[model samples]
Target: MTDPSPTNFAAPWEAQVFALVVSLREAGLFTWSEWADRLGRQIRPADGPERTADYGAWLTTLEAILAERGVAGPESVAARTEAFLRAAEATPHGQPIRLENDPLYRP
Candidate 1:
């Protein structure tokens, strides 16, 4: 198989989210086929791909699956997103970004 382009992700967080999704799947949370179908639907939604971050659509799909599977709820995801953003904003630049211990992140 051909290697993916080094610039496939628009940002570092996108790559991290992609890795998280793969790790979840590898941990038996879902099958490869399930991920393929869900991600395909997200990539080609009724409104078509949004003119935004490359893997933003993929992240949405992963969240939806996680919510449906009871791994996390919509509110939890939103809360964590907000919490992470807040943490990032508070952190000084040039330091490694870290995920905060958000009460919303159950896992």
Candidate 2:
């Protein structure tokens, strides 16, 4: 049976993550088969069974692969993530969130 319900990304970040994976693949960072294998392992770790459509796992897998390929270090990603979090928190409701909005952000 197939789901009759319309399927779409629940949030903008989900779409962004999907696009990022596609863009990376298109750029030859990794083959589609490699991506599927890594994503499968990520969703179904040795400690558990396959999870259903978890985009968080997708993001994690992307991060891991990027780090492995030396595209982005974990420290840089973490710092950027933290900066975004701070900026999001500092931004007023209905305003766009920018890294510059972060209180600790300089230049």
Best by TM-score: 2
Q: Count clashing residue pairs per candidate.
A: 0, 0
lDDT (10s digit) by residue, model 1, range 1-107: 37564556668888898899889989999888988788777776687553443577778888899899899999988877798887677667887656643333444
Model 1, C-alpha of 32: deviation from truth (Å): 1.1
| Predicted candidate 2 versus true structure: per-residue lDDT over 18-80, tens digit per residue | 999999999999999999899988888788777864788889999999999999989999999
lDDT of each: 0.77, 0.92
Worst ten in a row by lDDT for model 1: 98-107
Predicted structure with the largest lDDT when compared to the true one:
2
lDDT for predicted candidate 1 compared with the true structure: 0.77
Query: Model 2 Cα displacement at 33 (Å)?
Result: 0.7
